[model samples]
Target: MTVDLERAAPAAPPAPPRRESRIWLVATAVTAVTVLLIVYPLGRTVLGVFGIGADSTVGRIGEVLTSGETWRLALNTVIAVSVGSVVALMIGAVFAWINERTDARMGFAARMLPLMPMFVPSIASAIGWVFLASPKAGVLNGWLRDVGGWFGLEMVEGPLNIYSWPGLIFAYVLFLTPYAYLTISSGLQSLDPALEEASRDAGAGALATFRRITLPSLRPALGASVLVTVTMGVAIFSIPLVIGTPADIDVLPVRIVHMMTHSYPGDIGGALGLSLLVVAAVGGCWLVQRRMLAANAHATITGRSSAEAAVTLGRWKWVARSAMLLFLLLTSVLPLAGLVLVSLQGFWSAEVRWGHLTFDNYRYLVDNELVWAGLRNSLVLAVVCASVAMAVGVLVTLVLARRRGRVASTVDAIVKVPSTLTHIVVALSFIVAFAGPPFDLAGTYLLLAMAYVVLYVPQATFYATAAYHQVGPQLSEASAVSGAGDGTTVRRILLPLMAPGLIAGWSLVFVLMTGDITASSMLAGTHTPVVGFVILDMWTAAGYPKLAALGVLMTLVSSAVVLLVMTLRDKLLVVR
Candidate 1:
């Protein structure tokens, strides 16, 4: 008995000491780095709002609170977000209903088409819409004129002029409808067909069944979609920056950027102060969403391996197919095809001459120093930044899942701070915090990487946390009790088990960082010229062809990366 006790005791001290310390060390490092990057910048920005600390402004917080323009801007933001969210929800639900209910051959394409905007950078989308809808030199108008002339009718000369609130609404609908579609599609796929069947069997009509059964069952997903779309609509910078700035339309995110960039003497303090207000509002919305979703049960009809059932549309199948096709054409095929055609054509102002087709655009992109440099910089930044972000996410997930202490909870909360704030506010805070510090990390790859990490950590944590929850803690504990040290246990057990979630997290971060425009714009001062900024510059410079090519390249690269990740995840993570 003494000998057995001695052997077990020896295992206890050495095993727990090394393994526990290592886990804590990793957790601390991840938390500390995240705090420095996200927390510090956020703190500085909040302080700047009250005119506290260095570079204090003369204005009081009360004055800002009382400002009429503040309220007006807030109202404007709410209106745009509300309208955009509703429109996107309707479009997404309609398409998702079609994809799930009908036996459409193009359902695959319907799903794939919304994915185009995900590839094309946001600015490129704006540019494509502008070219198609511009009042003076729009291709649509030109085509309309030429077709009308054939009938000897008086042709219109001016452009279509998509430049105001309605124009911005049109653009937001184009981009945000995809989010609605994806979420609603997932919901539609997961819904139990039995409920609808029962409703119909009880003498309910199709529309009645949908209203009484299908819609209510999908309330959670629809709510989540609305909250997400509204949040994005409120924080949208690129759409307004490209279209609204030219039109002199002021929205909240645009106003925030303008404050930072255009304010006299570059009032970083004032900009950050305003940013805090935006952050507070957005944070409130996030908290509200959490509360609403907290109690809702999200039970799916199928497990990971089970394919979702297709609902029979019966007589309305063709109508459903047509709706999905129309959405595909409007959102994906038409815009993307327009981009390719316009890029190939020599001029937007003139009629397309097939003979004018040349490799000049591709050659120009290859030759331009800024374009090449930006591309190279974007790749390196995305690779390095996404790697660090994923690593941080792993640690974050482990701490949130395995550790139950107060310290772990605190760390978890801190990691979520960046997600609540707008990128402009975060940018302002970094400018204030690092401009004159011993730990100043401005204008370096380190700074950009940190920014990307903070920008994406919330999404990574959200997905990873869900994944970790799906993977029970019993496996890790059993491994530990069976003499597996923490490192060995994680390697042999937890990571393999949680591999799907990790891959999903990684894919999400890659897609987000690859196309990130807002934070990258504010953070990539000089050392980093990310793809987003390059798109911005090209659009500004009227290098439409180069921008289009660059946008195409970004879309292709991101999609390939996501696909590869998904494939690897399936092979490794799915428990056979």
Candidate 2:
């Protein structure tokens, strides 16, 4: 009996304490923030569309749905998006083909040219083009009219009206072609040239080979580029606001803004309802794009590339080079030069003479209190928003990479949802959800910063995810096995590896947020003046010179920041 008691009294093994994973904790925090900032606000907007929210009225949505004006706005949006996307596709396709295939002059320069437009803000470009194409006092139009007069042709006072639909399309094509070029050029670079060579050896002409082989091979990229251009054309706000507003043109985005800000008592329901249409259009395009991509698995090329010769353009190479240079000039250099010239002018006019050119506008911008305040606010917003976005995006990327569950994917999708909605739609959603009662943040800098974060988190996540994929997962696992917690692993191993991407993401968001007019127009007010809002105010008040001056300042600041970030990114890569 004593032996049995001793055996029974044997010590029980000590139980280990349950430890929660830091990854899960981070994932949960990111999810909560995303839902609060993105999902909740968007839900508020959707509810408003159905006239089921605090700011909504019964039958208002129905009225919007049945209104002829709504139909007309939808038509205008479709037309603009279609025509602009087509132009972008043609320009991007030709550029990609010439640069990737031909021995064009300045080949390296042409490849880099598409990225130059990225530094120029869309609002700034619109303003610049307006100065060059506006009916009343456009430099280019005046020159064109003068040339016509020499030919004894009675041309209209202003032959080129940038306020019209054609002008809108032109501006959109200029803004959107860069994106198309990037996508298509990357695809082109990856394409296997063996097929083209074989076709050429079989006596197929270049045009024939392109039509049968190259074009079909590029269908996926082409389609994706088209979808992207269309999406941007549909979602863009600043271009339409600057060019279309003066002409009394009411595109869907403009109409949405008008309804929310200008309508009596502010028709939140109607605006939300209108936003639903935009969402539907973009969503439909996205669906079709996905289906098209998924249905056609064109795996013509793999990672390996055979030694293939570049296409011999011969005499056509110079023509191709000229086309590339001309495209770059019209899209990036000209608009920027126009902005600089306008900023230096004493008064904005068709004539560009030494007497008309003065530094008064720049001086005025320096002297203006509003300009100083707006710049300060913009810097703060860009820095804070970009830092926060990159931080959150890194955490989410970690969870997405390490966690093996549906929750991670769902959370990733949730984070990307805001990207599909237009900036104005996102801003309106924030206004509806957080502008009152609990979590009231209206007219505050925090609100504007939050909107920017929400708008840009998707981009940050994309860059970080790409970086995360580049880093081997075994390293993280080894760190964990070494008793390093998830937080410590991220701080040491992951952060160091992700430095390039984080820096790049921060730079991109900073540049975009600094010049973003759509969200700023909707979210900012006197209490929280931003650069974009200030520019808009200047434009609205017919302060063209001041607006151009501000545009020039924004361009300089953005370019400096971008250059610094690029140098830092290169250094980080070298260190890694």
Candidate 3:
């Protein structure tokens, strides 16, 4: 009996080390790949700023670190990113709490179907608001001024200004809220109800319970939201370019682009040097987030968490619903309304002459070869990029599922870092690393595809990891016991089970790459033009009517995709 028991102990020990060894192998492999593909490029750019090894005539002898203007722009950039993230975070957290903790009859995506607005290229949102609130001839401002006479408060262009600091922040909040809402709402839905219920049973009121128990538990989500806002704030170009530029507000992103595009030799040193500040800022934020995560892990999600004990809002539910609808109105209805009206007009004007409206913009879109070529290219690239990224995600996740330890934990954190990096930084890195000489991939779709895959693979990894965890290790083990090989197990068991999540992730990636502006603006040229570049060109040419038409079309396509995903969710994601 003693010998048999000792034999069994040795057997169990052997199994664990083998599993652990596999995990370490995976973690090491993933780390090496990311360092080469993602980190190496970014690091190369940083080095080039100081006249290190670079093929381009970027940092000549005395030119390195000479741009004092970059330092000046950094101040305004810091202020805008900081303030915008805070305000956007507040709005997002408030809405999340109302939807999850209170008795509000609304969900950001579930019931409202507001993703249509969220999916619209942020460029459209910025431009739409410009039309709605610009001082001279804004649609809403004009209406407001017309109504102001009744109150004897009539003044031209005194009501609103979309070209000011406040306007920039507002646009940022609108653009960022969806990301925060998605992150925080998922966190809230996954919290343990027992803790909140215990607080209530101990005679705590709803507000007190929330302040003490709920808020503490939501630290991870809140931290993630803050990071998302900060990253978006740093990378965001559309609103600042359209709204802030008019007001002479030179943020870092705009400055970086101007250094590259507005100069003759293209000030690569100054541009990349400016990009380093963004890197430092992100690195600092990430450090803080990691510390917060480590210190506040008591509220972490497990597989067994139950539904929350929702607080009753009673009559206030209507008020909550109205507030949500009001957000939708501002984000989707107002912007789209403005786009439609402007597109139909001959030019942007406060007075809408129905007889003067024309469809010339739409006709041009249909007739132009570049527009069709851009659309086709974007479509093909989206599918290809998403597939490649997700394929890598699945491979990493499969290895991760084989074991669980410190190495696996490290691997998880490392995978998510790419998603946190600014898209502009990613684009600039790709340029500095692969755009010249040995690569000479400057104008090729292959370079663009690689950038998209590297930039977005983290998101794909996240979705794949979630799906894998949901299936758990039991099924995979069972398949192994039944004599199925790895490929067979993945095909017959894991893929089918993970389909719902994979589909959702693929859909997100598809839309994101198609409407991408930051990378497209920097990396793509006329030879390989994308939809984003086309839109930006129209903006440059002051073709407001044509821009509006294209913007409206993009919105419709986005909305249609969102609707299709929703409809398919019912049939495909069912757990029967």
Which candidate wins on TM-score? 2
Off by over 4 Å in 3: 1-35, 49-51, 55-68, 107-117, 299-308, 403-414
User: Model 3, residue 359: what's the lDDT?
Assistant: 92
The candidate that wins on lDDT is: 2
Q: Scored by Cα lDDT, where does model 1 land?
A: 0.70
Sort all candidates by lDDT, best to worst: 2, 3, 1
- Per-candidate TM equals 0.84, 0.90, 0.89
lDDT of 2 by residue, 295-356 (tens): 66778655334334578788988898888778778877777888888788878888789665
Instruction: Kindly list the per-residue Cα lDDT of model 1 for residues 1-576, writing each as its tens digit.
Output: 345534433444444443355865787677677867777766665665656777454374456546788777777777777787788889888777766664553645667665556655666677676766666666666777787789887755643666778888878888788878878887777787766766778999889989988887787787678666766676678888777777766777877666655554465544554565676667676766676577566665643321233456677778877776676666656556656667776566536677887667767778877777777787777767777777777777876676688987788888887665566766666767765577677566676776777877888777777667777888888997999887888788877777788787787677777778877666665456777767766776856666666666676677787888889988885563
- What is the C-alpha local distance difference test score of each model? 0.70, 0.81, 0.77
Model 3 has how many clashing residue pairs?
0
Better of 2 and 3 by lDDT: 2
Candidate 3 structure quality by residue, lDDT tens digits, 1-576: 345544434444444443334434654576558547876787787576655674343544135346566666777788778887887677777777777677674544533433444577788878888888889878888888888979998686748998888988888778887887778877888787667878899999878988999888888888887777788788888778989899898888887776666766566666666777887888878777787788786834443333246677799888877777888889988988888888888888766778888898888878888777776787788878988888778777776666589977777676676678788778878887888767888878988998998888888888998988888879989998999776677889988888788777777877788788888877777899888778777788747878888888877876676568756765776663
Residue pair clashes in candidate 3: none
lDDT of 2 at 239: 91
Q: Lowest-lDDT window of 10 residues in candidate 1? A: 302-311
